[model samples]
Target: MKYKVTQETELLNFLLEATSKKRNDLKKALKFNQVLVNGKSESYHAFLLHAGDEVELGKKSRQDLPFPILYEDKEIIVINKPSGLVSEQTMHNKSETAFMIVNGYLKKKKEKAYLVHRLDQDTSGVMMFVKNKKLYEELTHNWNDYVLERSYQAIVEGTIKKDGRIENYLSENKMQKVYVSNKKGKKAITNYHVLKNVKGYTLLDVFIETGRKNQIRVHMSSLGHPIAGDRKYGAQTNPIRRLALHANIFAFEHPFTHKTMTFKTEMPETFYKVTGKIKK
Candidate 1:
């Protein structure tokens, strides 16, 4: 059910006035991720509902969304996020992001979703979100316990002679530049295996046990081989025209079922094309 608000009011009060459902029932629906505000899931009952805002009482039909939904259930959702899109809204850019897009799709169904993690705007591939606040809080509070493995595929400059682990302490300066430090910050661990070598680049399978911001890019650059097209870290080439990194694989146990689940996406076709053109 959908209703367009005519007067400014609080969210809960608006729902009560629009529907005959009791306040408790409306609250239950909101907690279940059933209510939507302007194509997004909003749980704040007292949130002021602006006039003309669309309010959905139940899930609506979502179709032909921009992104692909890899997986979805009552508890969580997984999708293939494209490059050049931020995972969530930032202070500077209030434009559409993965979070807003997902909510837009959900809002069509009168449902809503929550972002559980984020991927850099230039990085593409698998990402996850939670449906309800309870599951969101549970998964966030014990992240590592629930997330079993997270891996990425990166095309980097130069050749990696052998597979190895890169462990270091990473710290960020005031300029937002992250670097490896000898005496500060928290430990970051990245294990990488060389899948193959192309022309002047290496195709690497990177598994990160620690989800540090810019961990993979920093670790690979610290090894003297920045990711291809990663001008921020020091890549000398622009074969792919963007950050040559992707979050390709994610494995985890269900927060509610405790069953192991894995999600994977094919590496961007352009990556293979560029690597193929590199002469050995």
Candidate 2:
């Protein structure tokens, strides 16, 4: 339950191992509330400790992350996550999540895969994870500058007035759920165009230039055309069985191979069924 930091230890990695939270959860614990540094329950970007900083687990702390892999290689892993599975697990939240599942998979394989990206629990689709040490190092080193062409498909309420782009900053308040803001947040951009309109819902082809959390759902909502079945950001409409978002395609240059690689997932059958189109 405890260990002193060594010269060789990465602080965040140490914290995840010590406190049993994923890197992101530890960031939340540090960034949000409840968890503390040196007995003070707050985060200061300047806070630094050398060898000994006690990480006390809150009474409700636990990490049980879970997720599925759509594709994997020596360089990366892609996940076809189902709705209701979290992308990552946390200490304060003991529920199963995609991160916990990935962690378990890696632990069993005795391999370490760095966290590469995220997807919402209710929005099922493709997510990528890096495999092998060298590739992991390369991706993490250049994540902010990563230039993968990531795209999605979603069914939104009604047809969009026009196929276009949405730009904004996204940040969350104390609740930890992401929120779209005109100011005081990270810059996010989403580009979408209608692919089909049926049964009062429009299926759109979406391209995300920036990967802020829930950018697609928020952007669609901002246009008065929320994603179908998005209970959190949109009206509760059961006509659609699940949050109508799908990470259908990911096209990028493999960091190691420098070759363009495109991975695609077939649209869930429910998506077609809900829209009254049964694929032949």
Candidate 3:
């Protein structure tokens, strides 16, 4: 089966509709890189349709959302992304990432969705996507003025004394991947609470007033409380397969109606365990 394009429906919609009708494997189309548009394979999920676009399901697109949707509204959707998924993909300097998953899902539903903020590849928990371009512009442009707070939960390798504050300069590493900083870098500050201490590790509830690239990772590493399971930092041992970090909540202003919006996500059971207590 096939579909004809329309202004209301996107290319992704046509494929989803067609695939839903058949027992044929949609996952196979996406995984084997079998899907194509206008006689070309397109892995990127946000490929906008301008009408008259042809699609073939080679392998079905993987429905791995990475995380669960904690909250949603007309203006925004808050998702708790699992560890090990990119926020968006890189195509023409763009990325096929988690952001596109939400966008594609809404597109299939005939609604709009756009990226407003992101979490790291290994970082789990709360993230937001805005819909309308106008609303997106407002939130992004006025992010400093709009959002009230953002909080993260992390299990670090060692106990943090004082359950307190840290301030430092941060900058991205150009030669090496993953953002890092030393001195003479942008100012980065993180406030943390040592909620739980066990064995040789500590669980921290972190808050970052400013959104910087890998701010939490770098800052915590510098403070000598590197997040548990972070391979990039001081946690040399593979205690866990993925980093034990998560964004539990993100608060911001509703771009459309000027209302204060707060989104919270629950921690996965693994979040509570460090080295030995992997069982739920």
Encode model 3's per-residue lDDT on 24-126: one tens digit a residue. Answer: 3453343234566666544333345557766765433344342456677776777767666688765423645777778888888788887888788778778
lDDT by residue (tens digit), candidate 2, 66-170: 333556776676776766567776665577676666766777778666667778767777877776767767766786555578889888887775789888899
Global lDDT scores for all candidate models: 0.82, 0.68, 0.69
By lDDT, the best candidate is 1
Residue range with the least summed lDDT across 10 consecutive positions in model 1: 59-68
lDDT of 1 by residue, 1-280 (tens): 8899998998898888889999887875664346778887554566677878999877633545555578887677898776667888877678568898788877777778988888988788899988788888888889989988899989999988899998889999887789999857979999998888978889988999999889999999999999998888999997755688999999888888889989999776557665664334
* TM-score for each candidate, following the candidate numbering: 0.75, 0.69, 0.70
RMSD of 3: 12.4
**Backbone clash numbers for all candidates listed:** 3, 9, 21
Q: In terms of TM-score, which candidate is strongest? A: 1
The candidate 3 region of ten consecutive residues with least summed lDDT is 23-32
